[model samples]
Target chain A: MPTVHVQLFKGRTADQKRAAAAAITEAVVATLGGNAATVDVIFHDIERHDWATGGKLWSDQPPAPPTPAAP
Target chain B: MPTVHVQLFKGRTADQKRAAAAAITEAVVATLGGNAATVDVIFHDIERHDWATGGKLWSDQPPAPPTPAAP
Candidate 1:
């Protein structure tokens, strides 16, 4: 069982995330010899305010949050 | 600062991992508005014996490990 955890800055479409998961799962199964069903992918979305770089906060100049997840 | 940890089966080239990291970092920067330098991607190679799913072990039917990372 291979668990892939991806922490992104929290502004991607569900379709993008799903595609990423599928691509990663395929890579694990074909390249790494992992069972497809056993491959687990989790996504953590961080708020701009919660993310930082070079000791600076992203929320300080936060880009407007993208539209909510497509319903 | 966001740190992404990926637990993969213990057999992939360093270059492959590096590529994966770069792609992910690009996605984070472009899609999620994260800084490129601050994106950290860590890969943990787990022994098949250490991984399990559906109450079964991966090591029991382990596929042979792949070639070592390119020098």
Candidate 2:
């Protein structure tokens, strides 16, 4: 069994989440040959204060909106 | 909007995925004040070859089963 974890700054709509989940699940099950029943997904909304990259917390970065096309 | 991504080695029942998704969605919505619609969860099953930690691929590590209690 394979469990995939993804981490990104949060910003999406409910419909987008649903679409992404369904797409990802299907991709994993069919393309990856993973059992559909064994797929597990979790999302964690991170605060800029809690995230850091290059020695700077995300909170210190400029505020930005979601870019659906990026993912 | 906050997008939360979670990845782990795969080995979960369909029921577990459903339960986890619901629980996580609720936690994000209630505890974090995130919108239910924007909560996205995606799972990737890692091949021992594809995942690495501490310079060792996961596949090289001992084969282990899921420890549901660990999170």
Candidate 3:
């Protein structure tokens, strides 16, 4: 069985998770040709305190400047 | 950088996690030859309801039969 685990910052709604699972499942089935039933996508909702990048915790990172929307 | 994700049943102590991270990091560094500082082993503690095998949730599986001790 092919199992995929995704760790994302928490607070996503169930709809978002369901959509992600469906899309990822389709991609896995298309690429690997496994029964769609056997493809499992497990989401780990992570708090900022639990994740770090470049030796710095996500919670402690400086605020990112806002990006302008395209006209 | 290679990122490894491990999904395990919850309730492991911090010491167990530290040991696992150390061992897995060592193996990855040995085989892949990356800086040990950059090796990340993210653990996702899965609830029985969140995991399934053979079209059934782990939470709903029948109780496992006891195995006799082997001398």
TM-score of chain B of each: 0.78, 0.69, 0.80
Question: What's the lDDT for residue A62 in model 2?
Answer: 88
lDDT of 1 by residue, A1-71 (tens): 56878777676688777776776566555544545776788988888878776787877865644433212
> Residues B1-71, candidate 1, lDDT per residue (tens digit)?
34667797776787667776776555544443445676687889887788776776787875645433222
TM-score of chain B of 1: 0.78
Tens digit of per-residue lDDT, candidate 2, span B27-59: 445443435676675544445687786898877
Give the CAPRI class of candidate 1. Answer: acceptable
- Writing each residue's lDDT as its tens digit, candidate 3 over A20-71 gives 6667777777898878788777777899888899989989997569767444
Pairs clashing in candidate 3?
Answer: none
Error of 3 at A41 (Å): 5.9
Cα lDDT tens digits, model 2, A35-68, are: 6566664544456687786898978988655333
- Model 1: runs farther than 4 Å from truth? A62-71, B1-3, B13-40, B54-71
Task: Provide the overall lDDT of each model, using Cα atoms, as 2-decimal numbers.
Answer: 0.65, 0.55, 0.75
Task: List DockQ, one per candidate, in order.
Answer: 0.24, 0.10, 0.12
Winner on lDDT (1 vs 2): 1
lDDT of 2: 0.55
Q: Clashes per prediction?
A: 1, 18, 0
Question: Whose lDDT is higher: candidate 1's or candidate 3's?
Answer: 3
